[model samples]
Target: MSRAEETADTAAAWIIRRENGDWSDEDQAALDAWLAASDGNKAAYWRLKHSWKEADRIGALGIAAVPTAPRKALARYGMPVALAASLVAAFWIGAIPFLSEPSAPKLVASTYKAGIGERKDVALADGSHVELNTRSVIRAASTSGHRDIWLDEGEAYFEVKHDPRRPFVVHAGARTVTVLGTKFSVRRDGGDVSVSVLEGRVRIDENPAKDGRPASTTTITGGMSAISEGRSTLVTQRSEERVESALAWRDGMLSFDRTTLADAAAEFNRYHRRPVIVTDPGAAGIRIGGTFQASNVEAFARLLRDAYGLHVEIAPDAIKISSQGVTAL
Candidate 1:
């Protein structure tokens, strides 16, 4: 089929989904992204919507020759005005009224940062709560129009209150997460950002460029994760156990489930000034699993030396691990 046809079909599907009475915040954000992608997309969506409404009106008058199920039913019994109102409400999910009062949204922005080995809990003006992990930085903003945050470093967990008038958004690395009300977390380590949803749903999209639109979009609900690096984002289903492990840092603990030695050390180093260096690729590949306090780097190193028989070298600023038979420091 042609590109225009495909766009119209997709828009029509969205309209139907909204009419099903279960349309969510994620769906509305998706609709906004679709509209912003291209002017052609907006035209196509409106074209199909107008045509659908016209067809229903003609069927109500028993004038259309269409034999479709909805059209046939409408021909036998006229469409109700209440149904038309409902259709209008459903299809207008993300649309702005042209004739409404012309006003701009008042934007409010603030920045918050946490130090190494320090955790901070923040309560916003909108009743939303944010917990910042060690060495994390975030900016929270709320206005009469919207609410959003920028995760500049490290990780944070959010417990957001329900407010359809204001969406809670997080900008991390190259991605943006939009939600109405949900329990979720966002972790940004350099160029990689991971988003985990614990309750409700959120829409993840590439950050729009200046005077440009988003590059990609996806929706993730509870027990789901979206990982973004560079220009790509991948969504995956996660077990409850894994989700809990991801959020365990809020409790001053780091939980690993069959995580690699290299990865486990990386988590440990996040909370401390000292770094962990893996010298042997073979030892780095060894999988270790357990729960440890975020500050218990010594115990973790001991476990690696005694249980795994890997060499451990300690320095004032860094710790080195290897598989070769070197004496443990």
Candidate 2:
């Protein structure tokens, strides 16, 4: 394949991967990097995406193939409505009556998104405040006496104003968190959502499957956390100090209490473009703890080299970490 064709195929693969499954933080980061690499990649991906959606609608409407000059007419008709007319003229007229437009979503929510290494503080019209973490997206709207937020990806801290008439609900993946007036932080990674309450109380509802069965709900008070992933939901209580530690990012710091090197690398990668890749399993599992600026990956790498006798290789694309003897590829 030509270079352009190869890039187009790569873009198409990324689009397919995102559409077929839950895209995690790593996938998002890689996609962001690929898009940033070239403008042609972005155009090709979007074109393929639009084509796929159009193909889905055409297939669903059962638009059969046209014969002879009708095929030429069908090709000439560019718009969907014109194509529908051509298909109807070629086939049975009653088939057109069976086609219906796709149903629109019930809520018309406003979306707020934060780019990589960027944090956003958004104030809702309803007196609620939200602090969106890097590379996060949330859709919020108030209707039918309910204030709902859908955390599509990444983390957000919410400070909800008291309103008994309007219950605040946050839908993240398979879990839903309901609060009245509370300060809470929610982190969504892939199919999991971690909720940490700082003030007041909130109830979390979890649905393991989409079978319409009753969802399990649990109430979490201040200094409590709940993690919902797939079929399991775990709730735990943390000390006030720990709760403060978890919210350290609000103050432009990342506090890690004996965090694994691999985990620490992942955390730091969330804030910056150059990923810290730990090559060796032993080096990756090494525990380190301290408060550090989220953007200072070089300092973190230096710390690993000086304190733990690890090898740090600074490359153009990534910061590779490994043991002293292990060679970094």
Candidate 3:
């Protein structure tokens, strides 16, 4: 078989395995690495995945079905022979055409989002990388000479490819962050925005003035952060450890250093539909420190119960915590 055919088959195998209900983070990482290896691989995977979804819909509609063959005869890498045959047939029949080198690069508008308890990695057409945090959304668009991103909500870490001709700009809340090439994260909570730079530099410009006051611009480099609240923007230098802790969500963990129980609960709530609520002011004021799995609300609650001698009431809708002997409401 040709190299293209081999790649297509591998892509199909990946799609089937992903839908098998046991896909893990390691499997996702492997798939991401494969897709990032080449544009052809990424295109092939997306195209085939789209076709597979269409095939599923058609099957659900009771349409004429693709012929089934014995698994041993055509199965490749555990893929169902009928499905594999359908994919190949689709390519040949022009339902999903085989990809070829384009005459010119196409700039496609795309949106990347992650639901609660989920994270997503997006490889952009320009070689940049974006990792969306839980409950986050971002819209990305590119033109021949420019690239733009709007952080509609939540947070995302960006590894931008250096392109002098195409300025990469991210709009979040009332601020705009521009970078030629850099590694950074932008988070939006309502009208507030925060930017943390891990490498290189970025420029943050406040949006046009609405109160007849002049807007401001700030430039921050590696190990620095900028926060905007209302009309004020504050830039501060951060320790390397603090920077790493801030980005821990990308690794599915939450790192807290002397973080308050209330604040920690808020952080955990972003990844869980069921919230962790500290019932009393005393428990809310209690400071704790650790790195915990973001999705493991039960584990964190257990820690509060065991280590802090706190009362933990685990209901179907929420986890309530308070000082020992204090009933959680």
* lDDT leader: 3
Q: Can you write out model 2's per-residue Cα lDDT over 1-329, one digit (the tens) per residue?
A: 45544654565456546654566767865775575466456554555544543654555666665333323333443325445334333332322332232442234467799999899999998999999998898978786588989887899999999999999999887688999999999998988889999999999888443343677888989998888877778888666777777888888789998899999999999999989999978898888889998877898899888887788999889999999684541
Over 4 Å off, model 2: 1-106, 211-214, 326-329
- Tens digits of per-residue lDDT for model 1 on 225-289? 87888778888776667678788998899998889988988888888999888987888888888
Report the CA-based lDDT of candidate 3 relative to the real structure.
0.79
Cα lDDT tens digits, model 3, 281-329, are 9899988999999989999999989887899999999999988695552
> Which runs in model 1 stand beyond 4 Å of their true positions?
1-106, 209-214, 326-329
Task: Tell me each candidate's RMSD, in Å, in order.
Answer: 13.4, 10.4, 14.4
A best-first ranking of the candidates according to their TM-score comes to 2, 3, 1
Q: Candidates' TM-scores?
A: 0.64, 0.67, 0.65
Which scores greater on TM-score, model 2 or model 3? 2
The total number of steric clashes, by the backbone 3 Å criterion, in model 2 comes to: 0
Clashes of each: 0, 0, 0
Q: Which stretch of 10 consecutive residues in model 3 shows the poorest summed lDDT?
A: 65-74
Order the candidates by lDDT, highest first — what do you get?
3, 2, 1
lDDT of 2: 0.75
Q: How far is 34's C-alpha from truth in model 3 (Å)?
A: 37
Whole-model lDDT values for every prediction: 0.73, 0.75, 0.79
